[model samples]
Target: MNHYRKIGNILESAMKMVLLTGITGFLGGHLAVALLRAGYKVRGSLRTPSRRDATAQAIEAAGGNISNLEFVELDLTKDAGWNEACTGVDYLMHAASPFVTSMPKDKATLINPAVEGTQRALSTARNAGVTRVVLTSSIAAIVPGRGKAGPPHLDASDWSDPDGHVNAYVESKIRAEKRAWDILQPGTTTTELAVINPGFIVGPLLDSDPGTSGALFQRFFRGEVPMAPQLYLHSVDVRDLANMHVAALTAPAASGTRTIASFGAYSIMDMAECLKKAFPAYREKMPKFQAPDWLIRLYALVDADVRANVRELGYNPSLDEAPGRALLGRPPIPITDGYIATAQSLIERNLV
Candidate 1:
């Protein structure tokens, strides 16, 4: 089937219900909006029931129809509602996972929740007979842990080595994604799985909260980061990322595969330039020069968070964009637009 027709058929099937985890998050909120707008009934999971109304408001503000949206209290660390939430769900969008820029003091704090959560979501979805599952993983799971001298270009075959110089967050994503694959091995269950390894995701926020990716721009705008680190990221807009997630649910080629969602690698200085061009008023605040490796090392000595990601300095890798282009059926949103939208959202919400 053609791309539009396939998506049209899925959208027209109003009976199809999607159980979406992490509906309150940056990507989750976008996914909920996309799923709802596409005519799927969404039952979003949340750790705190009180956030449901606010999350719904955020989704609604982002142009999602909440009439078909509902909420269930679920926790990654506990098994309180896994089976119950999975029951009667046609597809599972497992997007809920711990994410943080700063490394926790203990690695287990992040790793345990991420690994165990994927285990719970996949196991319960299989038991509940969900047709397919689309997991939201990160390029962090694909591109890190390899030394700075690793391959210039990375694809689905690449995996971040947990034993390498990866931090807690990268290790958690690697382990969690691995656990997901381990659970859904062929012959083990009828449920098919597709994983999306997206690069740095940035776009307009649905709410006032500046998520981990949004915080990148937040720091930049607020002059918290005076010097741009010698870092580069393969980037994507959250809207495209959300659509890619939904498309994976029905894309035949997506089954049993990891599709990358990134435009290309862009450096910290590149982002600063983009922002400076878009918002000339903020040009004075933008980092004029990239920090040298030795300066970054010295800064890390004073900041534990910087120390955690010290290994990432000067590391850059090209990501294969063919899978993303095929799945998206178009080029991903321009990286400059993604950067500008993020900054604009933060400014509009008074988050900066």
Candidate 2:
């Protein structure tokens, strides 16, 4: 076969292979579904082999090929086990990170794993000739929300200083993503990089394993939280976030851009009100109170999650979400869709 014909044939059979590092994560799980629907074979990794069964179930739920999905027990803190996972994968999505609310006494718990794990994943991909890599970074990496609201602007170029964050999770993500971006070697056809910076991701769980963000939204629906907070966020649905990640995998224009995706910014009362409107059943079930700033700070002292998240309540914040337009062909799922869907999901799962 001639060069062009041979290249086309190789591409056809390359399986459109992708390696998803956090297949069990909220976004990763959805991404596996998107990739499967688009005809790509996916391989995922966890810290242990035993986690494979859950990942398999997720792929199956998405109507994917359990046979097409493979899992590896890999550690982010060390280089071992990475090469095996990166082998023959066409792209890599580094979604694994230690999610937590409190600042660690030893920063290494969050920092070490996220930083080292990203290095190992990227090192392996570069060595393995992977074509593209998309990192599942949070807006937390871009906006740590430590103290000040911000200087009024930040984009792909902004960096969340490690010294400025109050929560370990934010610090870890900032440190990790910065470390990943700093990695470089002059070579073409090696692994090119992209980053997806999403705000609070919420949605229905495909299974019983509700993610951290999903579970928090559940509290709002259960009316367990009699009062909401001043907390506002420019959040996106987990499903929409997944689609953007897949788009980045092959979009040549996306190679170096950090696409900031958020459906719209809304607050605790605003979200509950949305649930009240879309899912009327939740109107009575959802919390109607909005916690005052003083009470939130008081609650933050004893509640670790509240304390770490206190920074999120400092002011009313919004996003310049229109920048992602060039990368998306259609508008993303609305932020409130996840809130309504969460209540429905809990009902469907009998978890309510």
TM-score winner among the candidates? Answer: 1
Write model 1 residue lDDT over 109-161, tens digit each, in one string: 99999999999999999989999999999999998766667788888998989
Task: Report the number of clashing residue pairs per model.
Answer: 0, 2
Cα lDDT tens digits, model 2, 224-264, are 88888887776888887887787787776778668887767
The global C-alpha lDDT for each of the candidates, from Candidate 1 onward, is: 0.89, 0.76
lDDT for model 2, please: 0.76
Clashing pairs in 1: none
Model 1 sits at a Cα RMSD from the real structure of: 1.6
In angstroms, the error of model 1 at 42 is 0.3
